[model samples]
Target: MLEDLLLQGAQPNYADNIRAIAARWEALIPPARLGDLESGDLQAGIVSILESGEVTDDVILTIAGDLASLSWWRGPPLRDDHRARLNALTRARLTRLADSLEMAPRKLPRSQLRRSHVLLVGNLLDPLHSPSGGAIDYAAALASDTAVSRVEIVHSGEVLPAMRTYIEARLGGFPASRGVALVSTRDNPDFLADILSRGPCTFHVWCEPALSPAISLVSRLGPTLMFTCADEAPVQFADVYWYFQSEAHIEKVWKAHAAPQEFIDRYVRILALPSPEPRPLEPMSRASIGLPEDAFVIATVGNRLGVEMDEAYITGIELALRSQPKAVWMVVGGLPDYLLGAFEQVLGDRFLHVPFSRELDRLMTTVDLFANPFRAGGGNSANIAVGAGAAVLSLSRGDVSSLVPDSFIASDPEEYFRYLGFLMDSPELLAAVKAEQGQHNARMRDQGLFLKEIQGLVRLAADRYEARGCGAPLSTTVFAPLTRLAQAG
Candidate 1:
């Protein structure tokens, strides 16, 4: 029924049809079955609607939100063509929305005013979720900085009891004068805008579908930075764009979006946030996790292992384990039933599946090698594995895994497998890799240095904004220095 409505495109009752399709989609698809649907048909349907030229902004927003949700829940598309088309269409709609709005000229901050406060806007600020972890870490880092006076997080979701407690504990670790607060507006864009307007602070926007309504407003408020999280293309309205992937990847996204060269040169910046500090954990033994103490443990950790785990990754693990009788596979994250069944059928007693846990640090202590699959995400987990003193082996791809040292990154799947075999066969080589990883982590985890870099960037942005002249159109000229600064970092 949904497909039929979508295929019909703009009908006499197009709005009603769209609403009905949304209702049915929500009713039929639960969270676990997000990946079960055939996205090709859905993508085609969405494209049809987009090209029909009769869709309203509200319906366009709905389609954009749905696409984002699918991307997040189902992982990145295996192929880029569909995603590219969808992004282009979505970008066009958003551009139209922005142009249609009669937005007031952006107000620049007073030169004498110190840029001490920062407002982080996002869909959810839950500390437990893997996607929100980077935002939380960024907030924590800002709070810890002496120069920053306050950190205000405006989120549009529920702050559950557990999440609030965790946030309190995490942010409370900083100085008492830092003044960190989480405000829940429950999807109220006007209220969110009011909060932003009330202060002269820098805004950091985390990319999420729920925050779609506020994007136009937020972009015009002071010096706004968009953290794309390596999931979507950078929204054009942001003054500064932050991404976890390499600069090359940023260029590719901008080119795909057909962004002007000047805009790309000025707004795009790589995320240079400090690596997370290793959390202290109680000693965990192999027996505690139901693994053999004598077996060599090779583990992979991620939040969405079901989406990330392909046949090749699973089969590689199976072959590796079969070749070495003493090898064991420990997967620490959520997995679909099919994947869980495959591991169970192949490895049986040798397979250890641990659900997403707070004790990942402890689990890493028991592992001999951290095997990272070739996927777009999982940089955070890979970094955690590195910080925990475990040797990480991953492909030399962009995303967070690029943070891994060059020596340990595999150029291809064959090299990845060969490296895995070599590490498993040689304990000394693995130990050396772990030592090098420790040195890399030490450099990356320098909070003081990282904080200084952030402060400098903020000042640069402020300077550029001021140079644009009062009530004048935003200039691309001032952004050149930022490009140099980002490259240097």
Candidate 2:
């Protein structure tokens, strides 16, 4: 069969395979570095892999897996079974590779054993660069962990000048040797390959459409445990998922999406990540964003990052804005032109756009209330609003419930509308809700919820490591002894 394909120029030789792989691999690597692959270097490398006298199944399998992962961003484009074939090969060859290439205990110093190396593949790298609050905060929390030895951030796209400074201070400032590497998947995906190739320690991901390739590829390589922070439960690719709300709500969402009950039971990890308590949001007014002093500001967050929005949602906002004349909808963050235009048209001068800010926590305090963005949902935006002591109102429930005030959770659309109208009619009712929310916010911050979740994740990851029989590993968890390290500057 191989001979026949070659006869008709179906494959031709190893060079064709390398070329085809390299073309698709463009998506995975830095655009600038891609020239070398097309200049015959990639094929030459492939030749060496095939001709090396000491080649093992692991060597071939690694190449196959890389190509498969690069090509199958979603699952093969059409009939290209490259992903499936490579996955099977990698799994078959993994044990042999893991056993032979395992890092020795003696070689690792005692200090190294105290911490776990975490490779984070997500949108975080710099505040000025991506300005994504969720990823940046999550990375900050993990980096602050005393038990974390190395936190390698795998980011993509532009790295502005400000990004470098932010990383150096927040992430790279860690005391651990080789503490942080702000890696670009485009510039050097090799660092990621090197880590995963070393054997599946674990891959933690925030499941977004953009990361489908990375997540799918990681699934192919060995016995890797993937912990995902996904608002919606994925049908495949992730191993364990961290959901930011109650089990009942998540179960309802999963079942609504047709996720099997067994799958949900096996994979979901209900972890209501705690709110980040920065210094309390300083006082500001409607004048901060060019609105009237008495404008009843309704705050919301948005981004061009493809947050889900529907027409019904547009109607909800339209109704919210029209319900009261003083209602000014202040959106903080970038929005698609269409949505932005819709808001602008509906509210005219009453709509305010504050370009996404790093200090959004402080800015959110300026608003009267944070209306959870209809069906789109909020990430750090909702958290900051609630943490800043502003009441949050959500029409549709999902993970957004984790951050919103209990006094403001609307049961259905009719009730949601009624609540909005009631609040618009009665100033006392709105102020009381906001006050109750402030009390709850104070309690949440005092309890340290976000930090606790990170600590819990470290403990869980450590448990998996020890159970793997990978020597009696020091717990990569925060114990009494490690408390000093946690408090260490």
Which is the leading candidate under lDDT?
1
- Write model 2 residue lDDT over 105-128, tens digit each, in one string: 322233333343444445444553
- How do the residues 276-383 of candidate 1 rate in per-residue lDDT, one tens digit apiece? 565676668878878888998999987656656677887888899988899999998777666778789877988989876776777788888888877766776777
> What TM-score fits each model?
0.81, 0.62
Q: Compared to the true structure, candidate 2 yields what TM-score?
A: 0.62
Runs off by more than 4 Å, candidate 1: 1-40, 75-79, 96-107, 110-114, 173-179, 187-189, 207-211, 253-263, 267-277, 466-489
Error of 1 at 432 (Å): 1.4
